[model samples]
Target: EGDFVIMGTDGLFDNLGEDAIAARILQAYNMMRIDGKVARAVCSWASQALLNDAFNTSLSKTAITPFSIAASEELDLAYSGGKMDDISVLVGMVEHQVQA
Candidate 1:
């Protein structure tokens, strides 16, 4: 399967949903494409953004994301209400194969 993959820990998903994460990654990827650069820096930035979003979601008092709900229900009460954990994200871009 030659496809781009984004592998992340539960902490990453606990705060942000798939749609949000996809949008962020697409934003980062587009930015890098416009800059004519594709490197680890972009990936790192994306990961940091995810972490920040997660942390902020945890702090927000107004609304709770579905991810947070699921996450809380699955874990201890201490982490029941919000997303407060170690976030980790990894993005892998697949290059087109060269035909022989």
Candidate 2:
């Protein structure tokens, strides 16, 4: 069993295939696990990275834009909107059993 995680930009998710989002999330989870990170942490990291990237990247022609604040607000709104769009997440766990 593997964790299926989905991380997406709102633009793509709002306009395109939902299944593609699911597939990409699962793919990301798998890749993260392969890279030696746990599912939950991976998800958190992904979200943080996405937010950071979005904040650093400009979204409009305005030269003085608060990208990070805007991105944070957008994410909050999306979660509240209940539109069921693709969001970033991590899945699964790895256990190293120890002898009792």
Cα RMSD for candidates in order = 4.2, 10.5
> What is the total number of backbone clashes in candidate 1?
0
Model 1 score (lDDT): 0.69
TM-score of 1: 0.69
Show the colliding residue pairs in model 1.
none
Number of backbone collisions per candidate: 0, 3
- Candidate 2 lDDT by residue in tens digits, 1-100: 4534444466333332444334545655776758876667766655554444333332333322233335447777422111223433333334456799
* lDDT by residue for model 1 (59-97), tens: 665446666566557774423345567777787666776
TM-score of each: 0.69, 0.33
Report lDDT (CA) for all predictions: 0.69, 0.44
